[model samples]
Target: MSPRLVRIGLGLWFCAIVLFLLFPLVFLIPLSFNESEILSFPPTTWSLRWYRVLFLDTSWSNALWLSVKIGVLVTILSLFIGTASALAIVRHRLPGAGLLYGLSIAPLIVPSIVIALGMFMLFARLQWLESLTTLVFAHTVVAVPYVIVVVSAALRNLDETIERAARVLGADPWRTFLLVTLPALRPAILAGAMFAFFASFDDLVITLFVSGAMETLPLRIWNDLNLRLDPTVAAASCVMVAMSMIGLGIAEFARSAGLRRLRMENTDG
Candidate 1:
């Protein structure tokens, strides 16, 4: 094909791909605002009824709140475990390092249902069922692998020479790590934390098996959908989508800024 023709084809392909991905979301955003009892294409009389229902219902509010709390906790927990484990795996030479890495990433590869079943049985044995503690623990276990992957990538790009220089200048290993290494890893850590938050917050399968009375948003949404599909659920979904988009926007903004900074640095050098 001629270069001009190839460029035209690629442009059309990219636009088609973008529309395919985004069209559903465009429909959904408007459909969520429908005042009608039923969700349908080209919804009638868009209003805030569903949104009002979401805010007014104590059960929904409480579940959403619980999910948020759990998500934040899981993110923090994942960052701690994942970032630490990533450093251990990537930076240190240890016997059976490959085995350790495999173990660390095992939860990600294992199906959620399988992990849920294992957790359910283990928690039942320990009498930890129905507890937020157990739910958070399980979520953290699953979410941490994301943190490990993100932070490890970030750590790799960070020049190790900074840490070495700090150590040579009479800084102890712990001090050098705290002041130098940790600072360099911040953006990646934030990215990992965001990933962990979303994973735990949006989780349904694992939460369903492990949790009982303490209902998270995903569990409540699942239960609601099972009984009867409601427009309110669509509203809630819109809210979740908005939340995710906010996070996505932040990540993209960070990436853009980082790239610009890198370009500036390269130009200066």
Candidate 2:
């Protein structure tokens, strides 16, 4: 085939993939505006009644609040643990660095259900089930891998000479890291925290297994679906999508600003 033909084929393929992935979300967006009690296509009326329900309904509001709180905690815990693990693997010539790295990333490859089951059993034994702290810890297990992957890549690509220069200038190891290394990795750290936040916020499988009577947003949605098919669920989903987009936008802006500053510093040096 000609080069032009190949380019055309690739563009068409990309468009097809995008459409396939977004088709369901596109279908759902229309239903959210549905003023009717039932979820129907080509909504008979467009109103914010369902959106109002999401805010006024105590169950939904509480679920949303709990999910946000847990997500924030998970983000903080994951970033702290993951950044330390990544730094250890990349900076130190530890005897079992490769093994430790593999262990850190194992959750990503291991089936979520398997992890969920194990956590359920462990939490049950420890009598930690149905607790927010336990949920946050469980989420951190999955979220940490994302943080490690992002931070590890940033660390690997970092120019070690800058950190060495700080050390040579009478800076201690901690000072060198805080002044040189941490600033250089800030973009990746911010991105990783965002990933961690979303991972916990959107999680369902593990939450279902371990949440028990506790209701996160996903659990509330599941319960709603089981009880009845309400247009309110559609409104809730749209709100979740909006929140996710806003978060991603903020994180992208921060990451880009950090990158620009790093580039400017490198150029000046």
Candidate 3:
């Protein structure tokens, strides 16, 4: 086949894949506007009533607030732990770094359900179930891997000479890292924060096992699905999707800007 024909075929394949992935999301938007409370596509009598219900209803609003709180906590914990692990592995090159890296990311390799079950058993035995701090720690276990991956990749690409230059200029290790290394890593850290937050926010299976009486947004959605089909659920889903897209856009913008700044710095050097 000619190169041009191959390019055309690839383009068509990409478009098809995009459509397939977005098919459900495309239908969900209209369903969220259905005035009747029923979740039906090609919504009849379109209205914003469901969105209002999502915000005004105590159950939905409370669940959403809980999820946000947990997501923020998970993001903070993951960033600290994951960044430290990445730095130790990539920069310090500690003994058994490969083994340490594998262990750190082992949660990503393991099935979440298996992890959830183990956590449930352990927490139950310790009588720690339903505790907010325990829930945050559990989410952090899964979310930290994303941070490790992003920060590790960024650290690998970062110029070590820059750090060395900072040190040679009489900067202490802490100052060099805080002033130079951390600034360079802002984009990766932000992207990792986004991933960590969403991982905690969207988790349903693990949360189901440990949350006990606490209803997160995902738990609320699950209950709604089981009890009734309503446009409120669709509206909630749309809101979650919108928030995720916004977070992703911000992360991408930060990454691009950081890259541009690095390029300019390199040129000046």
Candidate 4:
């Protein structure tokens, strides 16, 4: 095909894909407004009863708190382990780095069901079910590789000479890293942590395996969806999606700001 026609075709394809992906989200918003006793379309009245009911339910509030706590803990653990591993691989040039990196990334490629089964077995054997600590640890294992990949990319893009220069100026290794390296890695770290939070918050398989009595949002949603879905679920989904979108927006903004600063500094130099 001609280049011009190819461009037009690609544009049309992109638009079609975007619409297809967004259609369900668009449909759900209005559906959440339905006031019917059953979750049927074309409701006789539009009301806020579902939303009111959602807020009035203590179970949901507790679940939200639980999920938030897990997400934060998972993000922190992921950042610590992932950043350390990334720094070692990228900066220290550790032996078997490729193997280490691959192992770290294994969770992403492996079937989640398999991962869940393994976790469930481990928890059952250890009698650690319903422990948020185990849930955090398991999620951290899955979430860390993303942080590693992102932070390693940032480290790779950054020039090593800056840290070397700091060392030459008599700054200790710790000081050099703290002053020069960490600042440059901040944006990628922030992005990765945000992503980790979302991944853990939204995870169902692993959480379901480890969570016996503890109910995260996704588990709760899954159970409710399997039984009877109310417009409250839809409303809750809308709120969660909105929060995710906002977090994504902030991450993108931070990334752009970091890149812009880098470019300006390079231009000045």
Candidate 5:
């Protein structure tokens, strides 16, 4: 085929894949606005009643708040642990770095249900199920891999000479990291934070096994789905989708700004 034909074929293929992935969302968003309690497609009427219920109902609101709280906690923990792990593996070149890196990302490789079952057994033995702290830590186990991957990639791309220059200028290791390295890593860290939060917020399988009486937003949605096809669940899902998009937008903006700043710095240098 001609090069022009190849390019057109590739573009068409990409468009098809995108449409295939978004086919569900195209239906979901509309169904969320359906006036009827039933989750039928192509709504006969449209209303925001379900959205109102999602906000006004204490159960749904409380579950959302709990999920947000846990997500934030998990994000912070993941950043701390994952960044340290990445620095050790990528920057310091620690002994057994390969093994450590594998261990760090092991959660991603392991099936979530297997992890959930293991956690359930352990937490049950400790009588720690349903604890907020337990949930945060459990979520953190899965969320940290995202941070490690992002920070490790960024660390690899980062100019080591900048850090070396800071050290040569009489800055201590701690000061160099806090001022020079951390600022450079802001974009990757933010992106990782977004991923970590979503990992916790959308987690259901592990939460189901470990949460016990505690209800995060996903658990609440699952419960609703099991009991009835409430339009409220659809509304909650739309809210989550909106939040995910908003988080993605913010992360993309930060990444772009960081890249522009890096370019400007390079130009100045």
Candidate 6:
């Protein structure tokens, strides 16, 4: 086949894969709007009753709040820990830096179920299970690697001479980072925080293993599935999907802004 034809075929394949992936979400949107008690696709009637349940129902609302709180805490902790790790690996060239990087991202490679099981045992011994703090900590472990990867990539792309200039100007390491490095890292930091938040918010296996009594949004959805089929679950899923899309949009905007600033600086230089 000609190269142009091959390219056309690849483009069509990519579009087909994207549509296949999005099919479930497309199916769920209509189900979420269905007024009927049953979760039937192509609903006979449409209403916002399920959406009302998402807001008015105490269980769903409380679960949503808990998930948000955990997500925020996880994001903050992950950014702090991950950024420092990334800096150490990228800037300091610490001995065993490769090993550290491997360890940092190991959670992503290892099966999540294994991590959950291990965490369950550890938290049980620490008597930390069923606590919000425990959930946040567990989520932070999973989230930190994303932050590290993002910040490390951004750091690699940064102009190192600016940092050197700051140091030569008699600025302390801390001040140099605050004035030079941190500003350049803002977009990556924001992106990492969003990813971390979503990771925590969407996690179910870890939450199920560690949480004995605490209910997160995913846990609440699972409970609803077991107890009874409710259209409210669809509404909740839609809300989460919307939240994720909004977070991604904001992250993309921040990334573009950062790129524009970088371009302007390069031009000025």
Question: Pick by TM-score: which candidate is best?
Answer: 3
Clashing pairs in 4: none
TM-score of 1: 0.91
Cα lDDT for residue 144, candidate 6:
94
TM per prediction: 0.91, 0.92, 0.94, 0.92, 0.93, 0.93
Arrange candidates by lDDT, descending. 6, 5, 3, 2, 4, 1
Q: Could you report the Cα RMSD, in angstroms, for every candidate shown?
A: 2.2, 2.3, 1.8, 2.1, 2.0, 2.0
Cα lDDT, all candidates: 0.84, 0.90, 0.92, 0.85, 0.92, 0.92
Model 2 lDDT, residue 218, Cα: 80
Instruction: Please give the lDDT score at residue 41 for candidate 4.
Output: 66
Distance from true position, residue 203, model 3, in Å?
0.8
The C-alpha local distance difference test score for the whole of candidate 6 amounts to 0.92
Which regions of candidate 2 are displaced past 4 Å? 1-9, 249-269
1-269, model 5: which lDDT tens digit per residue?
99999999999999999999888788878888899988898888999989999999999999999999999999999999999988999999888998988999999999999999999999999999989999999999999999998889888878899999999999999999999999999998998899899999999999999999999999999999889878888889989989999997887787777778767876866
Clashing pairs in 1: none
Q: What tens digits encode model 3's per-residue C-alpha lDDT throughout 87-164?
A: 999999799999988999999899999999999999999999998998998999999999998899889889999999
Q: Write the per-residue lDDT of candidate 1 for residues 136-202, one digit (tens) a residue.
A: 9999989999888777776666667878999999999889989988877777777777778988989
Write the residue-wise lDDT of candidate 2 on 1-269 in tens digits: 99999999999999999999888788789999989999889888899998898888999999999999999999999999999999999999788998989999999999999999999999999999988899999999999999998899888878788899999999999999898899889988998898899889999999999998889988898899999989888888888888888888877886787767767766965
Residue 204 error, candidate 5, Å: 0.6
Candidate 2 yields a Cα-based lDDT of: 0.90
Candidate 2, residue 241: Cα displacement in angstroms equals: 2.0
Model 6 per-residue lDDT tens digits across residues 65-105: 99999999999999999999999999999999999899999
